[model samples]
Target chain A: MTRRRLQILMPWAVTLGLFALWEAFCKISGIEVFILPAPSDAWAAGVEFWPQLLEHSLQTLFTTTAGFVLAVGFGVLLGLAIGSSTLVYKGLYPVLVGFNSIPKVALVPVLVIWFGIGTVPAIITAFVISFFPIAVNVATGLATIEPELTDVLRSLGASRREILAKIGLPRAMPYLFASLKIAITLSFVGSVISETVASNSGIGYLMLAASSNYNVPLVFAGLLVVAFLGVLMYALMALVEGRMTGWAFRGTDLMS
Target chain B: MSDPEFHPADFMKPADFMGPADFIKVDGVDMTFSRGEEEVHALRGLDLSIPKGRFVAVVGPSGCGKSTLMRLLTGLAKPSAGTVTLEGAALRGPAKGVGMAFQNASLLPWRSTLSNVMLPFEIVAPHKRRLRANRAEYEARARALLKTVGLEAFADNQPWELSGGMQQRANVARAIVHEPRLMMLDEPFGALDAFTREELWSVMQALWMERGFTAVLITHDLREAVYLADEVLVMSARPGRIVHRQEIDLPRPRTLEMTYEPPFQAHVHSLRDHIQTVREAH
Candidate 1:
């Protein structure tokens, strides 16, 4: 392997080694299954409940994906509209910050009451949690164009709409993608939390059921699924970002 | 053996060369800017008339309002008083015939060099309205312009991939790609190294000579001012106003060897002395 590739792989190797040691310690200590199940037990539980686990995992995935898509659509549009206009930014920035400040989890009870104890509340929760980052990042990106570029465009007799499309939107894409990566994770977290509190399906509900029944191995299984889902979602967003911003990476250290 | 009271009629001020009807005119313009409670006058009753196809350079020190003059000419800012006109029409906003470049190239990082140069056509029109219908033509134009700057090989490269000098070449290409009648270059080569700067200067001179577009170049480098400009206007500091106007008597198709000659050195020394005197006076 190349030196750089070896360096990146070393951390993953260490993490795996640590996990193996923990599994061995649990097995040797003869820990009670209910108190702290061994990694083997958790893996066994995951295998045994594979069908149900997959279904619950897909439920969480659907809600998070739906919420993330909506968040990106609305957030990017709102950001562009506000960012393009100095007056709109001045008038609406405070209101946006104020709305973002109200802890999104606090609205869960109201959402459940309104949309009921199902996918709707989870989706709403995901949207609420994920939208702000996309909006803030996109606005920042749109507003931060270099003065020289603007001058070049202005001198060329380019219209306002041209500046928006050619310079503004293309320039803002990197920021929007960075925000998407953050938003996707938040969307997953929001869906899980909403499901734990008031949902009848999904991995979060499965975790709650396992905990109440003293099924520690099953609980670990659910946690592992959630972690896996988060990574999967993040990877998807990252892939999209990489493809769109391929030009931005050409000479930078990030290209590797 | 001096010929006294013999002046060429064509040596009149820029204002007199224009017919009553012309393409662009800057008449009796004054610009003042306020910084908090303090008011600073930038241009004081400045009068300049550019005929349709002339390359004009304005050289001055840092605070002499050269940039302010460019901003005013491009209609980025309104004069505190007086008028800037294009084709006998008052300029309320940026005119449709002007293109600009600055000291820093400032190509957008997210765009490839080709896309960055193609940006003007995509944004402004006659081209903008027809870009969708004529995408291949516009792309061809962008490629051709990039080739002119020796960047056709690196068309897919982003701004950061290129060297500072290369980026500035792209900047110049981007400025003129839309075929603007009036090109405003605000110290576009200021950030480049000596060799690269000289190289790009030749590239710029060639572009201007071939295209035959009117140009307004703002620069602090006197040699650059002398080498490229048909006429150079020097301005005084602070409440800036044009103090000296020198007409270059050098032959066209100027080469770097001309810059090393006695006449060129004499012109450079005279401009330096004038600037020094203005500085000391201020």
Candidate 2:
């Protein structure tokens, strides 16, 4: 096979090969179904529960998207404020770091107590967990502008507003997009953690429901669905990142 | 006259030889900047006067406040004591109608070369106000400037797509696109290879000749200072001040070939000697 074709097919081949190995291990060892279901059993569970699984996945997607949008808005504003002012940067950075260090899963219970066990808590959890990377990356991007570039603009009598508009924001775009890919995945983790703890809908809730009844295959199926969704969202973010900030990666010879 | 021995006292007040109606003047400027707890005395008791439409270069040892001089002339910083005047007016802030280019090309990587060249139009007024209405005219002017710098073909290319030399060419086009009357170059050609640097020297010369903008270049290259400037100023060590002034009476429209000739080498040698003497004295 050609190199390009091999590159495209490699991931699929490896994934299927792993599934085959897992299926063989279960068939030979005769492991208990509750402990570990075979790949075939998981596949059967997915096929049978397609409608419910789809609904849960869609709920998860909705909460994650809503939370991610909120994150983008608040994160960028906070980033601008912090990046533009030394006072804000010094004051808020420690607080942000402290908040980010706490396990986001630990906050799901608090969110449930405040918002009463539903989609609201899941969304708020996602927003809180995922916004840190975006805010930090944007601030870093703005802070690290080449002094020479600023000198050129300042010598032209560019005001702070003009400098921010022309250079700061656009320069921070790559950093923002980079954090989006990371933040979107983090949003997924946040949403699911909340759903598993408190919400009635989403893949995490579905998995929790299945596990209670000792339906190991159904739980595995839900997990597979969530993993697929995470990959899909990450791919979408990569696409948008390429479209928006191709110049940042131009050194890699990926774009003309 | 033959062996120009360097002497700080003889050149201390070179302003006496300066023309009456100086375009840019630094009068007894003293610049001291603080870095953390330590106060760094950069430039001290410095005096410089540039005639209108003359190309001047300042060459000195490292840390001798050559950059500080450029900052004062451009009015990017106020001297702690003395006044920096441009065209008979004391500059309160960054001088208006001045173009600056730095050692690095420093082009916005996202912008195409043409867009980069048009940047001053988005900042420097009344061009900023007129730019939208006369965008075609301004674009044409930018394109023409690019052509002069030999970058007309790469105007649509990103800065990363171009070679380092081409990027610097684009940088020069961006600097002159707004047609500022005063141009400040901060070791603009310092990063390039020798051949590329020499090639750009000609491009720079042609631009200066065509525009007649009063130019100040800060460089460590003795040959570059001698080859480009109408006069070269040498600076003393820290608490820096101009210590020697040498006029290059060499004829204009100077070429790369002319740089090979004895007169050019002689000028370069003397300036090198002055710098060596200045460094040792400190």
Best by TM-score: 2
- Residues A44-124, candidate 2: write the lDDT tens digits: 999999999999999999999899999999999999988878899999989999999999889988887788998999999
lDDT for residue B280 in candidate 1, whole number 0-100: 92
* Tens-digit lDDT track of model 2 for B35-119: 9999999999999889989999999999998888887887677799988767666676666557889999999989999999999
A53-99: candidate 1 lDDT, tens digit per residue: 99999999999999999999999988997878888889999998998
After superposing candidate 1 on the true structure, give the runs of residues whose Cα lies further than 4 Å from its correct spot.
A28-31, A252-256, B1-18, B21-23, B129-144, B155-157
- Per-candidate DockQ values are 0.50, 0.57
Candidate 2 falls in which docking quality class?
Answer: medium
Q: Report how large a share of the reference interface contacts model 1 reproduces.
A: 0.80
lDDT of 1 by residue, B1-282 (tens): 011221233223344435764655777788887889988888887877777777888987789899999988877778898887765556666666477899988888777899889878876668888999989999999999888888999999878989999899998998899888889999999988889988887888888998998899999899998999888888888778788888888888888999999988888998999899889999
Supply candidate 2's per-residue lDDT for A38.
95
Enumerate clash totals for all models, in the order shown.
Answer: 1, 0
